[model samples]
Target: MSCSGMETVDELELVVERLMDAPVAAVWKAYTDHLNDWFCPPPWRAEVQVMELRAGGRALVTMYGPDGEVVPNDGVYLEVIPERKIVFTDAFQAGWKPAGPFMVGIFEFEPQGDKTLYRGRARHWTKDALEQHKTMGFEAGWGKVAEQWEAVAKRLA
Candidate 1:
């Protein structure tokens, strides 16, 4: 349940990968510094309340839906590899205190010439959770967010 550098569990994970038209550095900067600008898809917006960006640091954000719905996510970073990878989960808080876990999120950005290969994954603790994520439109939602992230990276490039 620590999920630090854990391998993907096919039955409990959903992923979104993209070949972005931007450099790794730019992509990383956008992700680390401008998360609120691209973390959510259109009709929704995200505000990063805290993003310490180091192992055990806090990763908190509030997402707002167009219809006035607010979703606040609070988590801690499990690992951070600069421009390479980021792993976080709500399983633990900033002091490693156990919480009600939903999933572990892993995001990787690989350098590919002037472009970057980005992969985002959500690993759930149970099959029911995974099913719930699927029912919530995980693929389409994450895919749209990826596209938005890529655009932000491109602008940063």
Candidate 2:
């Protein structure tokens, strides 16, 4: 669907837009400061090994499951707008080193009256990867994370 003469990208997957009951500044703080607390779904946990929070800065995260499974993710911040947006990709590591591309994640926060509109999108490298991610429960997982994020934001507010 096209709106205002602009077409949405077809390659975007796991896109989620939610209205949070907090201001953008609070939400941003929750996202950046307490990421390890709400980044993963239930029964799983996130550990932020490193987060630089700037363009070309590093973000190394590891997710651990209840059963002790660990998944490492290393990425660089492509863009960062204070209290507004963040774009990161696993396509390149810190210092502009090329790595195996998995997904590019974009998160946007908008001021909506007394609340904030949170939008999230994950861009996959291939259709198969997209399908695989969907099958792996992207909605449920990301939705849970979003709920957790909102809770943190509201608490911070």
Candidate 3:
């Protein structure tokens, strides 16, 4: 992992950033409180099977397709920094059980005036995996989710 000022760039990382027109608290609330409402892009929905917001807690989720197909995501919360950051990984599950290596996501909210700078980074174990995720619409999908989150935050504001 390499950090340049407030930005980070790694060897095999996919990152998306946006300057949202909402406060940090509002953005954080949209994540912690209204995740299911905006976690997935439109036509797709997400269900949080289990989410304990503390460090080493569970973050099991499932994404349902428009036609009723489901995809399970087993992950753990690695670090939680209040309204600042959240680090989660699919390489391990609840109770620290090792699973197949996948993406480790880092979501950060930096206060900017009355708004927030939202950055989402997905690190993969291999370049191939990173490429695969890029091909899977990681940018568009995650960007959509962030946009939805900002809309929720604006509504809350």
Candidate 4:
């Protein structure tokens, strides 16, 4: 989708969007389910462990790259608004173990008539960090995950 001067801004200011093939509720569930089979990017698999759905709740999401190479990406829940929005940060793991500096993430669902305006935003610490993520194929990686999510959402919608 093209920019419409209506984009929301945040820390590192990274945003991605998709028109989900499924309904808003299904898409929202995919966003909340850390163990979702569709959360990982293409060519990689994921193992998720979601503890709760509230502020300070923990979620452990381990992404496995090619050949079962695992990279753990867990975080703490900052806020969750049912089927509308979710806020989390990469500050801790499932067991409340201290980890990396916080990277705030916001996922919002905007219903457009019969479609869902699915969006994801993540704020990194520095410009260099954001640039580093871009260089790592952020768009392509996340796009793939969105596609997977759409498929799952449609099936379960």
**TM-score of each candidate structure, all chains considered together:** 0.92, 0.91, 0.92, 0.84
lDDT for each residue of candidate 1 in 24-140, tens digit (9 for 90 to 100): 999999988899999998889999999999999999999999999999899999899999999999998778889999999999988999998888899999999988888888878
lDDT of each: 0.87, 0.84, 0.86, 0.72
Worst 10 residues of 4 by lDDT: 1-10
RMSD each, Å: 5.3, 4.4, 4.1, 3.2
Q: How many clashing pairs in candidate 3?
A: 0
Model 1, residue 105: distance off in Å is 0.4
Span of 10 residues, lowest total lDDT, candidate 1: 1-10
Error of 2 at 6 (Å): 20
Which residue runs of candidate 4 sit more than 4 Å off their true CA positions?
1-11, 32-35, 94-98
Off by over 4 Å in 3: 1-8
54-103 per-residue lDDT for model 2 (tens digits): 99899999999999899989999999999999999999987889998878
Name the top lDDT candidate: 1
Assess the local accuracy of residue 14 in candidate 1 as a C-alpha lDDT between 0 and 100. 84
lDDT of 3: 0.86
